[model samples]
Target chain A: MTQTALAETRTAEQGMAAHARAWLDANLPDALREDRPSTRRNTVAELCDWEAKLHRAGLVGATWPKEYGGGGLGLRAHLDISREIGRTPMPESVNSIGKELAGPIIMAVGRPEQKAEYLPAILEMRDIWCQGFSEPNAGSDLAGLRTRAVQTADGWVVNGQKIWTSGASKSRRCLLLARTGPVEDRHRGLVLFALRTDTPGVDIREIQSIDGERSFCEVFLNNVVIPEEDMLGSPDEGWAAATRVLSIERATNRMHRAWRFENQLNHLVSACLSDPATRHLAESTYRRALAEVSVNIELLKGHVETLVGSLIDGQEIGPRGSLPKLFWSEAHQGFARLALEIVSQFPVEASDTLRVARKRMEDIYLKSRAETIYAGTTEIQLDIISKRILQLKRKA
Target chain B: MTTDTELNPEDFVETARAVTTACAEAAGLPERMDLLAEAGLTGILAPEAVGGMDLPLGFAVPVLRAAGGGFLAAPLLECMLLARAFAGVDDALASAIVSGEMPVTVAWSGMLGGTSGVVGRAPLAEACARVLVLGADEGGVLVTPGEGAMVETESTLDLERPEARVRVTAASGPELSADAVARLRADALVLRAALILGAAEDCLSRAADYAQERVQFGRPLSANQSIQHHLARDCLAVETIRNNIHRSLSPECAVPAAAARATFVGAATLGARVAESAIQVHGGMGFTWEVPLHRHLRMIKALAAQGGAADLIEAVAADLLANAA
Candidate 1:
């Protein structure tokens, strides 16, 4: 309550805001501010081009090691850029797995040679990547995968199927988890490989989701040859390396999803220009949802900031990833559903634009249904909360 | 602007628990009206100069959380919210609040201007000597005995906090200006958020206890990993929502107006889930009137729909995606 304390708080607020503004001004391009929300507005090629431009502009890879093509800034600034990215709707960044999933794992456990090759391309978005972890029978129980990678002289010969592969069609390689041991070695035998998606033995077939975007694919790998050096971390240590994907420096994809959802909300509210009563209702509803989401963004930001602050001090977040991931995805799904409902109420002013957006919202809502189910179900999050934070024993 | 890690620290919670325990002992439980007056909790935001504890809304959240540890629900807590709003740095309202002399309540059932013409006046306008209403044309009213009266309706859930339909027959006292009312509404909402936070913490505790004690088939309910998991998950929801409420109150997170509706929805949604699950954990006993599970569950439902909780949730969710662009 003292004037000094109040003043100190305000000053800190301004400092943070200023940091966010600088990043936005420098990196958030004006070109992607389209009127309608498009799940498919940004393409893989376009995103790569923009990221390469960002790297050239010295704006990409904040927390990446100085050895890699990273800015070498700490995680606070890394997260700050993520918040800055939310302020604008530049096309979706394509190398998400590069920055979030692959890069972090590679950095944590990769050999020096592996980092020299893979990390820079990820920043440049030169190599599109997809995660081939979930198989037909394995989802929440991801350790029970059926993807088989057999040992060969050259490296490993992989022959298996990975369904629900995001961007498999456009991906150059995959951070794949395949079974090397028997079913009982569920958690132990799983190994990760950065395998070429275009190898002769690999086939990518699109699985068109409720969302019209064919981002999800059913990938088939038959005797696909993977180089020995491409594997991230030691053999049988995929899960441990995978933990890096949830940390602040590595979870930029979640940050991006949070940002994209925030942007779509603003467009929906403004575009509904007719019927004062309806428009006003739509706007009010959108505002409330935004407020809730703003809190979510801030919550995620807090989690990120904590992760970063702790990392700077050499502390680890461990299993708390469930909280942020579950919170954001559940909230994201709710927002997507709201966007669909609100858009449906509006009459078609311009059939082409409005109709497309309405249809898109519908698609996105349905497609996003899998997000909660994928990665991990909300139930799995509860499991983590109990066993980890609450320190509860496994059930009797 | 304020993040959770910075805002929700261990010390703040300690203060909340301390004040709540003092108030609980000072007054009675289950419905502690006297605690409001005993601890000057009735005037949490009233100026320190006027004998009120000069606490911000964020700090006050813990106090409310403490009171909720008991199953008590009463109008004294709500009165404190109005007092906080009306009592500025040196407002006379602060004096009245600290003394527990003045009483008032607000009506926001009609936020979209529908309440202005269609809805009748608040009964506190006459019955309780003061009334508060919010909207584009918003403000507090200093009512007299002749000004208004209420048609009462006791809620099935939180019976302690009685609601009613009011009719303003006369404006015997001064009318609060729109600006003054807006400031007060914001202040009051911050306080209301704290109160809800308290109630949510209560629901979580209740669920946790029931999980350990309630037995089914010769085993503790908590023995079920899934159920135990859910109870802890509820703890996280309440914690996150509480953290959000705290952020909304902080100077850095000065996203007050937004925080009000967002936290309300968050708490209500989570409270309902916890309440419902608590009942399920108790099995048949939870459904009986003797059990408090249904009471808290119904209370959350009532407050949730009454305010702009759902409406705000929908709007804010859209803006979240919107502002991203």
Candidate 2:
């Protein structure tokens, strides 16, 4: 290799390693407490405190433009930070909406004043946010959502309910996507607003899910009064923004989740260590699967980093982002299911490692179960691959 | 063998696809014998400067996938895998392999939970000069195929990658360096996975086609939601394996062989399930020897047992987890 090229590569690696180490050390939780899979709000809040630390340190939202009190680093920095944060079992950052989805979209579409009012608050955790998009009637058929927004001279009045709103009960703001077009224009006529969860007409009630975390809540927007400065993006632009938002979630987040699964896989390895034969056998199978998962994660990371690089250079990812999301989600599910199969015979809390291991598997299994269901289901991912990537004709 | 920086995966895949397609059209696994020698596939470790394709795992993987599909019934992969421990350093042997003149065999003896050195018959025993052996420690050795280098044909699941019983007295050839043995063990995985890729693809397409055309009740089996879902699930499984293979195909040995082991082992295990379902789709025809589905069933089982599938993938996972970044 040429000296100059070699120098450039070394500098990049050193910088990334330093950036990655800083984030990993600061964000990983100091401890892992639950023997059972836990996503309780308490766990989430503790995770948020780390984000608040990162916010204070100028590491969180470093990808955002510096005008909004962000670090304004590149995608490599963003990925390195995320990769590092995965080293620990900390709670998922509560400001996930702002740091991940809402911030990126708001930057693209929010009016200058709206940006000034909301962006800084979100980055600093002065206000927490939740997405009020999916409703009871709309899950996979998201465009069919019936939430309606009536235009007012001042702003818009929303009169509908959004269910499965993660963090709605605690959030200070909602990136509420409501229908503004005719009933038939399923996707086209939508508008987004940054309405306060504490607004007079807003009501939130937590629901019990299979995991029993109470992480998601139902939000009833009864004539929720929103202001003119609160609209996120242009009117009728919500669908596009939401789609971009989902695609971004698919690309950026799944890599770290895959990395986190490696820890669970490690615990599984320690399970069979006492028995040389089983250790040989168990470690053999699990190690190989872990290696395979690691390789795929690297591939996915490389892919997303490439896309983000192109985007930084003014390129769009098109529909291929679905490939990694679908692949990793299923891959994770397989990894989790494989863990259960390997260690099911162990008492629910056999080895401390096994007990710790079981919780990891269940958490990932639960999360992975959503992979094929959300960020587009497996079927949806396939459709995207077929129609968008391969451009295969739809069979009659 | 050398890593070809100039070759992209797409290009390697294209070459492999063409090669395998031609083989598939002709003799499936039955044709593997002549094809390996004809294509010089049994000599991948020979330097490209000496006439080999000289590719890393990425190039090797696609070729294996193609060969697996082609059902080229030969000890081609076994030869190349063992040959990794024999090339360059053994000038005469490597030169013969580069010229498509050397044929070799990989005898596990004690690898993959085997004891007393159970082995398969090698085609090159009487012809070519060298034979590679996975030793008592699961390490590999390249020894001469002369004198007490015994070879006997054992009953094999897939006739394509021929298996035989081998018994060696006190025979010896030029010993391989430790590094060569590691490379051989790793490539053994890639070789095994490549074959599974072909087998899995064969099973998936056949199952999908059968579901569309076969009729059980009034509706075509394809119309059955259960069947559609199964087929769709199988398609996803197959894609995951393929994705695993793609990642495995880099010049960097970090993932290729490891992924090959995990993916091939996983594919082989799950692939057998698909093959069983494939048979069910054909009803009675699936069981009868006249139908071709049994071949895949046999091949899948056969590949799963080869190159130490379970142990390798588990080891790979453990190592990866140990070094988590």
The candidate scoring highest on DockQ is 1
Instruction: Looking at model 2 chain B, report the run of 10 residues with the lowest lDDT sum.
Output: B108-117
lDDT of 1 by residue, A1-396 (tens): 578865764554345435555755666554544544445466556667777876765556765766788765555555455665665656556667667787878777778888898888888777878888888888768877888877889998888888989888888978888878776777887788888887788999999876566878999988888888877776676557676555443323545555566556555554553345346545565566546555565554434444444555666666665666777777778878777877777675654455655665676688679878766787887777776766654343
What does candidate 2's lDDT look like per residue over A315-344, in tens digits?
A: 666675675676567777777777667666
If you assessed candidate 2 against the hidden native complex, which CAPRI class would it receive?
A: incorrect
Which CAPRI tier for candidate 1? Answer: acceptable
Indicate which candidate wins on lDDT. 2
Q: List TM-scores for all candidates, in order.
A: 0.75, 0.79
Could you tell me which 10 consecutive residues in candidate 2 chain A have the lowest summed lDDT? A32-41
Angstrom error at residue A136, model 1 = 4.1
- TM-score of every candidate's chain A: 0.83, 0.85
lDDT by residue (B1-325, candidate 1, tens digit) is 1233544434555654555555445443322434456655666655566666655555556656665555444445556655655554336764665565665655545421423321222323233445554434555454433335333343334453445444444333445667766665455455555556666667667667767766677777777887777776676676656656655654433345665655666666766777777777677888899977666676666666555566666666565445433
